[model samples]
Target: MSTEGSVSNDREGHVKTEGERSFWGRLANWGLYQTLMTVITLSPRRQFFILAAFPILWLLTQHLGPMLQMLRVSLLDAYPVAPDVAQEFSLESYFKFFGDPIFWMPLFRTLIFAAVFTLCTLLITYPVAYFLARHVSRKNQMLLLLILLIPFWVGEIVRTYAIMILLGNTGALNLALKWLGLIDRPIPFMYTSFSMGLGMVYLTALYMLLPLYSALEKLPKSYNEAAADLGAGAWSRFRKITLPLTIEGISSGSTLVFLISTGFYATPVLLGGPSTTVFAETIAGFFHVAGDEWPTGAAFAVIMFIVALLITGVFQRLMKSLRKGESS
Candidate 1:
């Protein structure tokens, strides 16, 4: 009787243990299912904010910190005359930049040069980009692209020097021209606006080309085919369809080229005369060559930054408007 009782006790213990385990398993499954549902039900906007938080924090720390520091420096009365001494906070530098024609004139010249260069870059690069995107065979396209990129292998400074050599009074082009009796005297090509523009164009041509090519490449060939089928001539198809599709690229390339060209110092200094001084040169002169006026340099830098921001904002709005019009 005792043995039978012992066997029954063992069986009861085993059943109780299984019941406890099943209860815990059901609890665990319920918690896991609830978690999954919560995750699935999260709003996309909330998720995006969560995902973007770290990157936004990082960017703020990187960019805002330096900008604040620069602004503080600009606000202080600093001069190069006494390198070791610090002056009280003053608006002298900002006033100097605004009140002085030397600073303002160069800034104006810089704007004009950048605008002219941007226009020339667009005019020259658009046709080349269109041809490459639409006309060339795949095999030849690759080869031509390689050729276009070959000039970039050389450094910008080296290329500028090369331009100097080719355009200098006694340079190869001048020698050839003399041999051909094109001119009796060698031309003074270096240290001129023409040379400055040429160098700027050469350095920035690729910038314009890549964006334009990408824009043109994204255009549907079907549009052109349909236009042709509808008795539209080649020029008409290009004017109506191809040009409209590539405006974004043109705007993007122009903005980039203009911004870079505006801030250009080395090319202008090397190739341009005194009359062709750019804003960047003025900033450099204030900081290093003329006198170490940190506040003045900072003021100029701030103004340039604001101008660039304005240009970029305008371009973005224009692009958006164009896209909306196209969609409509």
Candidate 2:
């Protein structure tokens, strides 16, 4: 009887073990997850390609696809051609931009605004980035960065409205000035170039700050210390050592801010008066008109894109040369 009971107990233990294995095995072998696991285990290169496929496809479909479509439309005489009508392509849309002088001022204005705003953003954020990277403790650095980022978490429109509220006649700034007896009446800060510029700088500050901070953080403290030991003053060390080292960050941040500033429509419209209309606002006007005007808008957009790229290319070459000079 004892022998029989021991044999039965062994059989029961084997069944339980098999049951647990079967349950886990089913989960591991489920559908696409199993296929992915198999590829990952068998071929690392194949695994990488599989992982990268989605983003590559998304870029092709979402970004490149739209640009190509826009380019095609820009060459056409008219978009949304009737079923009975033959699709005719021409350079008229593009010609419209070059032939007219009315469009010139806004384009020039946009470029100038973008350049100024980019510089302002860089100047303002550099000190903050330096302080955070050099003075703040490592344990609390992330917390401070998070606090800075919280404002950007909201939509651009919301943030623009917040700026509107702050700069309006009866807003915080004016009220504060009045309270301090600096002015008897509220300053008309709204719908002006200053207000628009202020909004642009506020919006693009993060783009400049993060790159500067990243570059500053990766920089070795020993270099600054060594320079100081050699009797270099703070300004001398910063001008010679710190500035040269972080040129790449400055270029990256400036480029991003400039590109973003050129494309702003809503903020400029809301904050700017008639004199401050940007090329983006002009481009938007074309789109807001009849469908026939879409091709014109597309053409103008392409012109702006090409011009911006040309400017950016020149800027990048300058930055590259500067980097080479620093390294040498």
Candidate 3:
């Protein structure tokens, strides 16, 4: 009788354990389902805010956070300070940039180079974008774009290296010219302003191309057709209709390319000679040193950033006025 009683007790204990597990599992599921229903019942604006929380967090932490830290560092007298030393804030870092004239050439050159390169990119890519948007069948456009984007799939360093190989003395262009008897010797294409400019244009071409293509594609073909029907020539149609309408694309592409060109370090380093050194390299030189020079680099970076922004701001104003004039 005792043996049978113990067996019945074991069965009851097993059933009780299962009941406890089921109770907790149901509770967990209920809580989760209730939370989801609450979220679903939220207003659309609240839902949007919930969805946007991650991206806003990323922008704050990843983008704004680093810039703020850099600004703070720029104001400091030194970084990586002695463990017990107090921090000193000063403007001497900023003064160094103003006081030293050696940095002037690279700074000005970077601005000029960025502007020229951005314009060249615009001119070069505009035709290609126009053809892609206006001439090509819609079905093949994505395929063509994918083909064009193949070169950009690689990292910037790899692309810069490819440029180096292509522009080297005995590279394909030189060899082809030699084979054609066009030149007696290979021209030195590497380590020059021309090489740097070529690389900049190549790197920034996509930025210009996509915006122009978007603007061109979204443009109503009817506008140009109507102009043509009214006895407008091709150039006239483009000038009066296409160009005016596409000003936003030009502005956006130019701004993106100019800003990107100003900050390029790898392509310029690889393709540029001493005479072609840009402000970025100069700023990097400061950080490369062992000691308090880091603040100076940070300071110059801030200066370059501010100057670039001012130039773009002026460009934006001009573009906006042009847009207004075109619209009027």
Candidate 4:
């Protein structure tokens, strides 16, 4: 009788345990279902955001996924993993790059030229942008902006090529020079660093000009007039009023010019002499032309990106300091 009772007790215990597990499982499923229903009942704005984010997320994945894949390939020992070489992660390529003066010299040269180009553009475009913003009538402003945009409508390659022809040995400028008896020879204008710098500025000057115009155009005219009425000289009024207000334009224009000048490769290649070596072109050669050197190229790219980030950060800090000084 006791044995039979114990057997019945065991069966009851098993049934109770099974029932508890079933109840918990149903509870978990109900919680998940409730969460789904709550999401369905979200506010219209929240629902719209959720829906809107899906496409953006998809696009990000599409781009970032490939970039991640490329980054992985760059980190790998070789393109094919080199089964016999015992593959492992290494910074050997970067080490090799940093160890050479050829790499360092070109990089410094590029930075210097890019700085000079940005400075020149800022100086050259500022007057035009200022005139457009302050002095020009509205009708003229519209007409002038349209004219300024004309060069951008034309392709960079075509513009650069046109420049090449104009600066070529037998091109229009040389012919004009010969006609004027300005020089005896064609003037060796075709392949030179000066040509490279000129092309870079010509192609990218609009970027700086437009930003300055945008910032300066929105200023309240009364502020400058008010300052002038208080006996502030024209230069003082400009230094104290116009400049502080248009700081954003200066930052934007400088940054745009700097970024473009640094990243430019084709212009440098087309217009530059053999001695003019920008790191962007060097990076391209390692990836596209050099044999089995893509890893080195990738390393170079990573370094350039970091360097650009650092430089931009420094510029931002400087701009902020200037802004603070003006505010005080």
lDDT of each: 0.84, 0.90, 0.90, 0.83
What TM-score would every model get versus the actual structure? 0.77, 0.85, 0.85, 0.81
On the 0 to 100 scale, the lDDT of residue 249 in model 4 is 89
Q: Which residue runs does candidate 2 get wrong by more than 4 Å?
A: 1-24, 27-57
Q: What is the C-alpha lDDT profile of model 4 across 129-200, one tens digit per residue?
A: 999999999999989989989988888888899889989999899999999999988987877888887888
Cα misplacement distance, residue 257 of candidate 1 (Å)? 0.8
Which candidate should be chosen as best, given TM-score against the real structure?
A: 2
- In candidate 1, the residue pairs with backbone N, CA or C atoms under 3 Å apart (3 or more residues apart, or in different chains) clash, namely none
lDDT of 3 by residue, 1-328 (tens): 9978866765575587753345434454587876985886589888888889999999999999998888889999998677899999999989888777788779999999999999999999999999999999999999998899998777888888888888889888788989999999999999999999998898889999999999999999999989889999999899999999999999999999999999999899999998898999999998788868888888889999999999999999999999899889
Give one digit per residue, the lDDT tens place, for model 2 in 1-328. 9878856765565487753345344556578877878867677788788889999999999989999999999999889787889989999988888787778789999999999999999999999999999999998999999999999887878889999999999999999999999999999999988999999998999999999999999999999999999999999999889998998899889989999999999999999999899999999998888888889899889989999988988998899898788768
Off by over 4 Å in 1: 1-58, 79-87, 289-292, 319-328
lDDT of the structure predicted as candidate 2: 0.90
| Candidate 4 residue runs with Cα over 4 Å from true position | 1-53, 83-87
Q: Looking at model 1, report the run of 10 residues with the lowest lDDT sum.
A: 19-28
Q: What is the C-alpha RMSD of each candidate to the true structure, in Å?
A: 12.3, 7.2, 9.5, 15.5
Error of 4 at 77 (Å): 2.8
